[model samples]
Target: MPVREMKIDDLPQVLQIQKALAFQDWNERQFIAEITANYALCVVYVAAALHTPILGYAIFHLMGPDSELLSIATNDSHQRAGIGTALLNAGIAHLDFENGDKIFLEVREGNTKARRFYEKHGFEPYAERKKYYADGENAILYVKAT
Candidate 1:
């Protein structure tokens, strides 16, 4: 798992991974906003042997002591291969360095795999928002201390 701070040049590959696995479809503009935002920490997991193509990415927004895991996804071909976990660990390390107190995230109810993954990683689900998604899917909100 070779991880690094996401650079602007990585958006094309990141966007491709996002398109294949993201819960919320984010355009290039949104990705740019995160890359340029001072409060956001975006990290990418690259395959060193494959010319460093992005295998996954994680976006974390740090607001003082509070933070949010905005999005995280691994390319479909690389799913369940620890790419997601590597991205998550990288994001958590960055958040810790920034003195973040907690990390929050919301996952679609139907995304059981994601929900399970979060829970497995120590995130505790505290609430659920009905019809939180545009598709009327409920979103389970979870939080974990950094």
Candidate 2:
């Protein structure tokens, strides 16, 4: 998989893959619109396979001096194959963290698998917010210091 910053033209494909992997039903249009409108603050990655069009993507937002991971997902057909990790590495690489600080992100507390994935990448839970999701799930805040 070749990971790089996503072009505006890639939004549709990225949103489609993300919505399909979402555990809870949600509107992907909002995500697409936000990333499109906020490209200056967003960094996304697309994973292309040997014979496939695109397998998955990851998006992150840069706010002030901090980088926040917005979302990350792999196509169902490509899950557990390291595409997600590749996307994450690519997203982090795009950040202008010359100060060598930490990156942040929030994930559903019930998403044990995703939590473990972040932990494997050096993200540590530092806080939590209640009812952060449309489904009323709590969001666990994780940070990784580079």
Candidate 3:
């Protein structure tokens, strides 16, 4: 897999992946804004073979010494193949290299798999937001010191 900065042309494939996943999906404009933002870091993981699909993407924002992982997702077909992990590790390393002091993200309270994945990467639960999702699910904030 080759992880690289997301390009404008990649939005359609990215949107398809987002639509297939059961999560808070961002609209095309939102993705465009993030990709163009001065403080944002957006990356995509592309499959190695010719004409292969994009496997995953990660979008984060860095402000001062704090970084927030806004979204990350792997295509359903590519899940559990380390694509998400690679994107996350690459994002964290990018943040650290940029002198970030801490990184934050929020996962749905019921997403045990995501929570466990963050925990495995040394993120600790810092807070919770009630009814953070449109579906009335709470959001668990997780933070990792860089």
Candidate 4:
């Protein structure tokens, strides 16, 4: 249950977790970009076993006082095991909250489980973006303030 900064060499296992999840479509190139971005916070939840090195991943971008949680997910086989929570808590702790930073994230309108998860972590739903996704589902925006 150790969370650490994501490394390029971990992409294969990370991609496998991403492919098993439904929300994120980010490819290897995108992950590489994030890992290299100065303002991006990308982390992975890892296991000791070599066969399943990564169990979850979280990506965030920080801009001055605003931070955005771009994506976070746990492998299907690892779901309900607190990996997601560990990833999210680590990401939030990285944000510059002392300066009154606020974190933002969006969830698909129909994703009740995700909404609940965010809410449980103290994110409050504030707004909605219509037809935000290609599938035309509204995006519910949630925010957490320092």
Candidate 5:
């Protein structure tokens, strides 16, 4: 699988991928605004194939020096095929780790699959935010320290 930064033309595909994997309503306009405003380090991943639709994407926000993984989603059709891991690894590699020794992300408390994915990548549970999801689930904050 190949990973790269997302282009403007990739928004629709990205949206589709997000919808396929998302557990809540994520506004595309808000996502676009945040990404464009922080384009210096934020990115999205696309699996490579002949005219293949997007299988997954990851979004990150670099604040100060540390990176925050805003969201990561792999389409349901492509789940369990390592696409999510590939996207995450690619995003992690893109960070300026020499200056920032940590990456953080949040997953819903009930999202066992997502939590397991983060844990498999060496992320540790560090904190919790109550009612973080629109559906009223708390969120567990996971961090990977380099």
Candidate 6:
């Protein structure tokens, strides 16, 4: 698992994964903006020996001691192979290096598997936003103290 800063060339593969796994898809401009934002960090996980295909990606923003995990997703074909875990670990390490004290993210209330995964990774339920998604699903917020 090679997790590194996302490059412009990786956006295509990243968009593919996002379209498959994300609740809302972001366009190339959004991805580029996040990657270039001063307060943001964007990374991609490449699994092949040649590092050609991106398996997953994470976008986070750091503000003082707080960090927000904006998005994270793995390719549908590469799920369960630890790519998501690796990308998360990398994001955590980056945030810790930046002296961040906590990280937060939101998941759909109906996404039990994602909530379970976050729980297993030391994230605890913190709050909820009713009718947060476009489909009217509630959003469950999870927080982790780093």
All candidates: CA RMSD in angstroms? 1.9, 2.8, 1.7, 1.3, 2.1, 2.0
Residue pairs clashing, model 3: none
Predicted candidate 2 versus true structure: per-residue lDDT over 37-74, tens digit per residue: 65434444443444445676666776656778877777
lDDT of 5 by residue, 1-146 (tens): 37877676777887777676656566778666766775544455554553766677778877655678888888788788998888888887777577538888888899999999999999999999999877789999998988
TM-scores across all candidates? 0.92, 0.79, 0.92, 0.95, 0.86, 0.91
Residue-wise lDDT of candidate 4 within 30-111, one digit each (tens)? Answer: 9999999999999999897768778889999988688899999888887888988999989877774775679999999999
Give lDDT: candidate 6, residue 143: 89
TM-score of 5: 0.86
Local error of candidate 4 at 36, Å?
A: 0.2
Candidate 3 per-residue lDDT, tens place, 64-113, comes to 68789989999888788898899998887777644338889999999987
C-alpha local distance difference test of each model: 0.86, 0.72, 0.87, 0.89, 0.77, 0.85
**Can you tell me which runs of candidate 2 are displaced by over 4 Å?**
24-52
How do the residues 1-146 of candidate 6 rate in per-residue lDDT, one tens digit apiece?
Answer: 49999988899888888887766678999999998899998999887665547888898898768788888888787777888788889988877644338899999999886788789899999899999998899999998886
- Which TM-score value belongs to model 2? 0.79
True lDDT of residue 44, candidate 1: 92
lDDT of 4 at 67: 88
Q: Pick by lDDT: which candidate is best?
A: 4
Error of 5 at 31 (Å): 2.8
How many angstroms is residue 73 displaced in model 3 relative to the true structure, after the best TM-score fit?
Answer: 0.4
Who is ahead in lDDT, 2 or 5? 5
